[model samples]
Structure formats: C-alpha cells, structure tokens
Target: MGRTASVLLRVLGMLWTAPNTGLGLIAGSVGLPFGARVHFDPHTVALVFHRWPWGPGGAMTLGNTILHTGETLDAPCLTYAHRAGHCEEPPVRIGDHERAHVYQYMALGPLFLPLYLVCGGISVRNRFERAADRYAQTGRGWWPW
Candidate 1:
C-alpha cells in the first residue's frame, strides 16, 4: 500500500464505477462533438492530479490544482495533492462552486478576483452551465462578471 499504489487504486475505483465508455449522450447538449470524450464523471469522486513536472509545491495541492483548472478553463487536468503516504483519500470536488468560479474566471479574468473569492460559496450550477453552453455555441469571448 504505497502512495503511488493507493493513488492508482483510487483512480481505478473511480473509473470502474463510471460508464464503460466515459462518453455520454449529453455531449451534444453541451455543444461538444457527438463523440467527444469526457475527462471526468460527475457520478464519482476521483483524484485528478495536475501534470506537475516540477513535483510538489507551486500550488500542487489538490484544491489549488482544481482551482487553477477552473480558473484557466483547462481540461484534462490532474493533481497529486491528495497523497497521504499509502492511504490517500479521494480528492474533494469544488463541484458547482468550482464550476461557477470557472465560468466567472474565464469571463472576467483577474479583474474579478474579489468575486472569485466568493464563488466557492455560491450554488449556481444551472447558471454556470447556461453560460458555458452560450460560450460553446457562439464562440464568443467570456466575461467574468
């Protein structure tokens, strides 16, 4: 039960619980191509580690990596922050709050730092989804406000 092994098990467990294809019927609903692959499933909690070649520190924590991805709209992200030396726990998701932060961060940039601080406290997944849908449909630039 080493750290790497534990992380692998966690990832495997998460993937095992997910639909075999990892693609869903709702892909088109989000304006993604019909067969576009999803990076993560909402049904299960998994450890997503950012590709940190630098290794440790530099916002390498799970929360920071997840927040960074949300802030930058970077997909296919990962993090190694949840490691606990052979007994790593599943990473906690910012969920709707993270989603909302992502939307605002993409739309507003650094100017909306104050609001971004509060985004994690809000529950507005529907609004964020709608905003994302609009962004995908028109390819218009987003505003963080």
Candidate 2:
C-alpha cells in the first residue's frame, strides 16, 4: 500500500472503531484513580493501562484499549486461558495477542464484540481468541475468521 493509502486506512480504522474504543476507554479509566497507569503503545496503536486493579491477573483487549494487571505486557501469558502460563512450544508475547485484538477491532468496528461472543464468549473454542494466540505465537492471523 502507498503511504497515502496507509494513512487513510489508519484514519478510517480509528474512526470506524471509535465507539468500541470509547467503551474501552470508559471502562479502563475507572482504574486510573486506583493507581493504574495508562500509556499509548505505538506498536499496538492502542492505549494500555498497566497494573489495573481489576480482572483476574492478565490482560484484556477492548477495541484500542488494553487493560493489564501486570507491569509489562511483553511477559508471557495467555489473555484468557486458565493458568496456561508460559509453556507454549515457543514463548508468546501478551502484547502481540492483544495487538491482534486491537487490529480486529479496527477491522470489525462495533461488530467485534458481538461477533466475538457469537464465535464463543471466552474459551479455547473461540476462533477470535485462537487467532489472537496465533498472532502472538507467529505474528499473523489476527482476523476473527
């Protein structure tokens, strides 16, 4: 893609995903007063809140916002798996998986959540999660399908 086209596409993606991103921002901001720190990640093109006081003890990607309970996202972990730990054949970076979800939100816009649930709310059965895992493991295949 040309430079102009790439820029335009990014603008459109941000605009298209604004609603979902808004929801994520709202939910994520609730943690700010409790000591959570937020920063924009250029690589993921998303806002990430670290040391978020809610959720179990991993991370979640909602639109362009990522909420993480840990100090660093590059740490090995599964976004939603149970005690999956860092035992994949190859180490997985949490940031990469969450970045895929950010990209998915850019592509699907408001439809991301509904489609994610329909695909499977949360589990290994969900293709969306699987795709994110694939992206984290191999740096590709973040699409919902």
Candidate 3:
C-alpha cells in the first residue's frame, strides 16, 4: 500500500474504534488519581497507562488504550509472557498482545467487546485472545475472524 493509503486506513481504523477508545480513556482516567502514568505511543497510535493499580494484576487492552498494573515489557518476549498459561510453547509478549487487541478493536469497533464475550471473554478458548497471542508470536493475525 502507498503511504497515503496506509495513513488513510489508520485514520479510518481510529475513527471506527473511537467509541471504545473513549470508553478506554474514561477507564484510564480513573487511574490517574491513583498514580497511573500515561503516554502516547505513535508507533501503535495508542495510549498506555502503566501502574494502573487495578484489574487482575496484568495488562488489559480496550480499544486504543492499554492499562497495566506492571511495567511495560521491553526485553525479549519471554517464555512466560503468554496469558493462556501454557508454557510448553513460547510466550506472547504483553505489549504485542495488547497492541494486537487495539488492531482487533479497530476492525471490530463497538462489536469488539460483544464478540469477545461471545468468544468466551478472556479465556484460552476466546478466539480474540488466541488471535492476539498469534499476532504477538508471529507479527500477524490480530483479527479474531
């Protein structure tokens, strides 16, 4: 794709996912008073909130916002990074997995959460989550479908 087309697609994806992103932003806002730090990542075109102080003690991706209780992973993707907890295979980098969710959210838009629940929410059986893991491991296949 040409640069213009790529840019346009990115913009379109952002627009399509705006509603969920807004919700994510609202959720992230609650973390601000608790010392959550926020930063804009131009590479992924998303907002990341680290040290969010909530959730199941890990990272969560909602649209373009990612909330995490731990620090961002910068080292090589580790064997224990996958959320499914199956260590026989390689692990999925949390950053990559969450970023893949952002991409998935762009494609699914408001349908993301509904479909995610239908796919078993956050379990290993959830196709959305499995796809995110696939994306993290291979750099592709973020789409649940």
Candidate 4:
C-alpha cells in the first residue's frame, strides 16, 4: 500500500503539472463512487462527471477551492485541470482536498474503517466528491448554501 501510494502521488503530480493533457483518473481502493473527468482549456476548465451513488457537495467545495486558487489538484478520483496552459505554476491543495483516495482513507480510518469496510470507505469518498461537485456548480467552496 505504501509503494502504491507513493507511485500514485508521483503520477498525480505529473498529471497535475502537465497542461492540456486532461486528467487521467487511476481508481484506488479509497476512490470515489463515480469519478469525474476534467479538461482544462484556454479559458475554462470543463468537468465531465460520473455521479456518485451519494449526493453532491464535497466535490463542489474542493473544485471551488482549486478554481478559487487557480491551482491544479489531482487525485485518484477527483482532479483539477489548469486553464493557464503552463506548468510553471502548479496548484497547491492541502489536507482533505489534496487527493481523492488519500482523503478517503483519512476520513474512514478512525471510526468507520473497522465497521462496514465497503460503505465506510465509499462514504468518505462520496463526501468529498459531493463537495467538489457543488463547488463547481455554485462557484462557492464549502460555504453554507
């Protein structure tokens, strides 16, 4: 798992840094229910979403952060493609919003990972995905709607 995480981070970093290539998602154990594909063009970044079994709120928050910061955030499930067309300035995402799978593990590890393995894991992922998705649609990050 450690090696896989390391490799995933490296790959995500590469994808995030590369411009115009679009996001190539690599699903992991802790990935979202239905991932989304993002394409960053010259002016705006277009997101093609695969709606998760859960609702939409987490993805919206996270995506809005990337949009607000003008940063490129890439994870196994969710990713942000840059509109700048340049790799010099890469987006900086931290904590739960940094990567998809990592955040899932972090979310479920404490209380839920021990209980129902599948649902617990998916719940963590779905939450974040919802946030990012909402963020995309509303242009508001995690702020009370």
Each prediction's TM-score versus the true structure: 0.22, 0.90, 0.89, 0.20
Candidate 1 lDDT score at position 25: 22
lDDT of 4 at 90: 35
lDDT tens digits, residue span 110-129, model 2: 98999989988778778888
RMSD of each: 17.8, 2.4, 2.3, 14.8
Q: Pick the winner on TM-score between candidates 1 and 2.
A: 2
| TM-score of candidate 3 on Cα atoms, chains taken together | 0.89
- Ten-residue segment with the worst summed lDDT in candidate 1? 58-67
In candidate 2, position 87 carries an lDDT of: 40
Better of 2 and 4 by TM-score: 2
Model 3 pairs in collision: none
* Top candidate when judged by lDDT against the true structure: 2
Per-residue alpha-carbon lDDT of candidate 1 for residues 1-145, written as tens digits (9 for 90 to 100): 8999877865554344333112222221232332222234232232222222232322111211131223223332222222323334333233432443333433343334444345542223333333433343344422433
Against the unseen true structure, what C-alpha lDDT does each candidate score?
A: 0.32, 0.85, 0.80, 0.32
Query: Can you write out model 3's per-residue Cα lDDT over 32-75, one digit (the tens) per residue?
Result: 99989999877566898888988777677788888878777442
Global local distance difference test of model 1: 0.32
Prediction 1 TM-score vs. true: 0.22
Candidate topping TM-score: 2
Error of 1 at 94 (Å): 17
Candidate 1 vs candidate 2: the lDDT winner is 2
Model 4, C-alpha of 81: deviation from truth (Å): 25
